[model samples]
Every structure is written in structure tokens, then in C-alpha cells.
Target: MGVYNVHERLLVARSGEVGALLDTLSSGGDGDALWPHRSWPPMRLDRPLAPGAAGGHGPVRYTVTTYVPSAWVRFAFSGPRGFHGFHEYVVLPVDEERTVLRHTLAMNTGGPARLTWPLVWRPLHDALLEDSLDRAERACTGAVAHPARRGAYTRLLRRLLRRPPGVTGKP
Candidate 1:
């Protein structure tokens, strides 16, 4: 199965201001303002944001294959057995005081992922990206006009998939 997913938000901020968020992915600690670490697993890279840096949140794993500071970054999947392709975040300038922050996940699933992608991964991935965009909006404008809320099934899935305290795994 081939899966193509995208999530984006338009923020009333300069492109430079919104673009800087791209440089902060997986910085760890409290430095990453674009990922919603408070509600989801934090994205962690093996090294700083750059080509070849590896790591991912939860059970998914990928490696940074391309990066343009303050503009864009792409991560190619390397694990979970069946995911093949990349996910990327890009900043698009709409005007002097408007910017569109977009994330795209394009991949092909085989093996078990053929089932898991639609049943489990897709819901979680959608919610996570929405939360991520909420973070971006909040960081840029100090508020979110309309926050994304997880559905009942997604909440249940998260509860069921959450790792125990001190155990390293999906949220």
C-alpha cells in the first residue's frame, strides 16, 4: 500500500520566524518548539539536524537524508520492516507576514505494515501531525485559533500503545 499524508498550517508570521522552526527538530530537551512533545513522543536524532543523522520517535525510525537550514528537512524511513520512503517538513512563504508550514509523509507499506498502516499507524500519525501544527501555530502566534482534538478511538489507541513508565517506546 502506498500512503501519502500531509498536514499544514498558515501562520501570521514572517517566513523567517516560521522557517526557523524547521531547524529545531529533534534538538532534544526543551529546544524543539515545533514538535508536540508534551502529548506525544519526542523526535530524537542521533546527532544534530543534518544529512545522515538518525533516530525517530517511538517505534518508527528514520534517517535525515536532506536538510536546508531554516527551510526544509526530509527523513527517509529505515525501520518497522515495511515503510519505504520519506517524510518532510517545509516552510513556504506566502507573503511578508504569512507563512505556510507543511509536513508531508509519502511511503509505501508492505508486509505487516499493509495492515498496520491503515488500522493503527494512520490514525496516530494524523493526530500527531495535527498536534505538531498546533505547536507551530502556538509558537508563532501564541495561540491556536482551532486546536486539533483526538477522537475517541485515537485516544484509546494511544492509551493502549503507551509504554510504561521508564520504558522507552511509543507514547
Candidate 2:
């Protein structure tokens, strides 16, 4: 069981604006310009973002466990085995012109996660979150000093995963 948290502060946007940005991502993904940098898989909920709503992307399935409008939302994983916990987004206001956005993943990895987490999941997660925050910053400030770039490791992992399993690693 491990509790992992990641966050970003929007120094140039208001709480409502940041909330709306997050809502846009939650509802329809970040589109082409920002898709690759999302912290979470492109979510596609069957219903609206609210408590008890069910949805997932890729290999993950979850049910919304909590929702507090533009402030917070949590989803509890229901599949992929050994993953028992929830991931959530929280929005906190720093001032009338600034906001803090956070994402938290708290779970107990039982089966493969214990191993996969350290070797693969953690690295990918960190990269993705930082990239997502970079996009957020760009959205708020109209520019970012340094943009996120997928490195060799991330690219290799993506390529490997895209290959059909047990294919002798030839692609």
C-alpha cells in the first residue's frame, strides 16, 4: 500500500479558471496539443463527472466515489487486480488570482503492482504528471519556459507496450 501525491500551482490563473481547465480535461481530454502530457489516461466517462459515475480508459476501470463540483473528485479503481484505492483531484485557492491543483493516488498494490510500480509505473507517472502541470502552466500563463518532452525511456516503454506481447521484442 502506497500513497502517492502530485500537484501543480497555477500562479497566473484564478481558481474558477483552473477548475474549468481541469473539468475540460476530465470531460473531454486535453486534445491533440496536450494529449501526450496528461497525468492520467484520457478519461471518457459514460455519464457526467459525479459521484457513482463509472468509466475508464485503456486498462483501468473505476467508479466515482466522491465529487465536490469544481473543487474535488475521487474515483475508486475496480479492476486490474491488486489495486485497491482511489485517485482524486483537489483544487485549492491561493488567492483571488492564483490556484493550486493536485492529484493524489492512494492505493495498496497487492499482485504485480508491487513490482511494476517501482520499475515502470512510478517513472511513467512522474513524467506524465509533470508534463500535465507544464500544460496547465502554459494554459494559464500563455507560455512555458521549458516544455515537457518525452525522453528515450518513456518512448521506449511506449513502443514496447505497443508491440504485441511475446513477440520476441522485435518491432
Candidate 2 per-residue lDDT, tens place, 71-130, comes to 878889985676788877777899988888787878888888778766666666667766
> What is the C-alpha lDDT profile of model 1 across 11-120, one tens digit per residue?
99998998788788999858998988888888999899999999998889999999999999999999788999999999999999999999999999999999999999
Candidate 1, residue 153: Cα displacement in angstroms equals 0.8
Clashing residue pairs in all predictions, respectively, total: 0, 0
Model 1, CA-based lDDT: 0.92
- What C-alpha lDDT, on a 0 to 100 scale, does residue 113 get in candidate 2? 78
Where model 2 places Cα greater than 4 Å from the true spot, the runs are 29-41, 163-171
Cα displacement (Å) at residue 155, model 1: 0.2
| RMSD in Å for all candidates | 1.3, 4.4
Which window of 10 residues has the lowest lDDT sum in candidate 2? 30-39
Q: Which residue pairs show backbone clashes in model 1?
A: none
